[model samples]
Target: MAPALKRSYQFVVDNFLKLLLIPTALAISNKYEEIMHLCNSMHFTSLHLLCASFLIIYALTLLLVSRPRPVYLVDYALFKPPRSYRVSFAGFMEHARMGRLFSEPKSVHFMMKILERSGLGEETCLPPALHYIPPTLTMAMAREEAELVIFSAMDSLFSKTGIKPKQIDILVLNCSLFSPTPSLTASVINKYKIRSNIKSFNLSGMGCSAGLISVDLARDLLQRHHNSYAVVISTEILTPNSYLGKERAMLLPNCLFRMGAAAVLLSNRSSDRRRAKYRLSHVVRTHKGADDKSYGCVSQEEDDEGNVGIKLNIDLMAVAGEALKSNITAIGPLVLPASEQLLFALSLIGRKLFNPKWKAYVPDFKEAFEHFCIHAGGRAVIDELQKNLRLTNEQVEASRMTLHRFGNTSSSSLWYELSYIESKGRMKKGDRVWQIAFGSGFKCNSAVWKCNRTIKPPAEGAWADCIDKYPVHIPEVVKL
Candidate 1:
């Protein structure tokens, strides 16, 4: 028996005997009282009382043993990809030209010419008004860009799911940097004309990992309500916060962030299982805040050159590895097969006993997951996670391609990766997918999904038409 089961069994056994003895002793005392009162024969009365006591104790024990155990179950899966998707090169160049980041109008013209040569210019879907701004006025023009991108993404996701806004029981929105006065959730509710009874929550500043965190919250709500559906929208805004100055700390965002968003529908109604792609399996969250070294590894700061920049330290991969280790340690025992667990345990013991300084044994993640979605925070983050998890190039390609095509959409990045998989027609029934994300609270959160059926990729989906030319092998730049 497992240790926990054994302990519970021992506890019940010990308590059962004590409970039985209590009634028997009470019966004997009652018999003594009857004898003194001359109400009945002591032996007969004692036997009668003892028999009744045994029945009561037996019934109580049965009740204790029959209580139900808590089981986490998922019943519906509705995936949403953004409606309007734009490439980073187009978005960034527009921002640069308007913000006057380039001194000469010729530089803006040259960049656009290069994009046209690269076959990307024909692909841009930005508004015409955005293109007429001079290089010096880009910052002002970017004010509503994030909102436009988010609305487009949400509109697509909601429409594809065929979920009427009025039918949604709960709404959750996560945007790390932008939480407007009316709030994004309010905007969604207004746009959809959702029912007034719908519960809504808006999460801000939770960082990229907040996407999974929101999913976790939605799962809890579904489990409690059983038949209700929850809508989760994840996106990042880009307008007023656009940095036009030469601050390196701010410059990283300019290069790294692009417009994207995703919506997901979750439910606990068993009737919806046939249409769902995956069932929620498990969610694990771990925060490593006290470790200052890891916290600062990928943070935004001002460089010596006075440029606001996001520093991608060489050691961030190592930091992410540590976070993944902590997450796996908590998650492995729950999902890993017994044979794999045994091997992992033995490997761990051998490493500790033979060489304390030896690196911890990393499990073969392929044994645990059929597909993997590591957050596309950056190229280096993805590469490091691939190495640490021992994942194949194919498994990591979905993330890399999403990053290459969309940049970091913060919390919404994972959905793009999933969209990539769907667009390629790679998801299969019974496959297991794992999503791991790292973010600002120095938080690492993961979710596991078990595919319920083979899903046909969406026709007008975010990556549906563009996945054929992806999985680009962008070589890592080696700094001298």
Candidate 2:
């Protein structure tokens, strides 16, 4: 009986222990699963918050560093004189004061021979103010020239752009030879009655390259002031600047330097992109004024008789060569593609470290620009540039034709060249055009522009009436 009781108690104890172990094991497993689920949910939430924070920072950075608006050339107009102002080469010499001076006949003849190679046509126009006796250089005559040429160009441009005077926020006027007390800027402001608070700049004595300098200035100003309009006037008052001295160098400007002016409008407003003609891509300026030879290469001075005129250094060509080399060096890196730049870098390295006689490569600018508007300073200038740049005849045709028609209208000549190109319908969308200028400050300036729209044949422009007759055979000399 005792053995049976002991065995039954042991069995009951074993069953109780087994029941407790089963329930506790189930509870432990359930607790472990809850803890793992809570950890996974927290980890996922943290990951999602981190992704949101990264996106917010990137969006804020973009908002803080907004892109700047591009500067564009809305449109432009150039002045054309009346028919009475047109003078043939013979007609010019027949009216010269030199014919009366017995001592000057030889010098005048020599100068005429030089003019034969000047690349000027018979149709070049002189200012009406210069028709007077003693060549009318008075302030009143100067005012007349400016009113006729500058005002006509500006007025026409205003009409074309349909822009009111009040709309112009910035005004830049450049007249190298004739700067008055009120300044050309004030004169423009006064004529148009522009706003009193307009930003006005008058650049004087900078010579033919002043036009591009003015453009560069306007571009910078537009970049700073959002959605603005600027008007730039480029002209040379030929009436007061004509040199009547016996010195041949001083007399060169008389054979050239015709009456012309150009008015350009630029904008930085986003809405203007549709109407704009060109977007200014780059402006590179280089000055060699530190070199005494270059500084004096082109200068204005008084002769022994007290008549003021510009004197060209006999070494002007050399100075121009050096200046151009420097200018293109700086400009190459800006406009050149990565491949060209790398090659140029390699060539320099080769010359510096390996071989002293390694030829420094001349970049082919034609690859970067479809059209080139070299300054119409003279035939020699054109020829030299053509040779130096290895440009084809067609590439320099616009410049030559502009010189033949306008006879070096000083700072405004480049616009006439561009107008010639546009009138021919050669300028297409995305085509790049280059304008290179040389000035009295011993400066070489370049501006690159990309056409925004396909250019059509202009209805009325500087080249409108006679563009068809041009690209004609120009002789080395037109006999009197």
| Candidate whose lDDT is highest | 2
Tens-place lDDT per residue, model 1, 399-421, is: 88887666677888888888788
lDDT of 2 at 287: 95
**Per-candidate TM vs. native?**
0.73, 0.87
Task: Compose the digit string of candidate 2's lDDT tens values, residues 1-480.
Answer: 276884565455436667688989989797998879887877667778899899999999887667556899999999998889997877777767343431478667866786788899888899876765546678988888888898899999999999999999999999998988878788888898999999999999998999999999999899788889999999999877777678777887888788899999999998999999999999999999999998998999998888788898899999889989999999998887554566678889999999989888876677678999998999889999999888999999999999999889988999999999999989999999999999986999999999999989899988999999979787777665
Q: What are the clashing pairs of model 2? A: none
Per-residue lDDT, model 1, residue 349, is 92
Runs in model 2 deviating more than 4 A are 1-66, 97-103
lDDT of 1: 0.69
For each candidate in the order shown, give its overall lDDT on alpha carbons: 0.69, 0.87
Leading candidate by TM-score: 2
Residue 200, model 2, lDDT: 94
Clashes of each: 16, 0
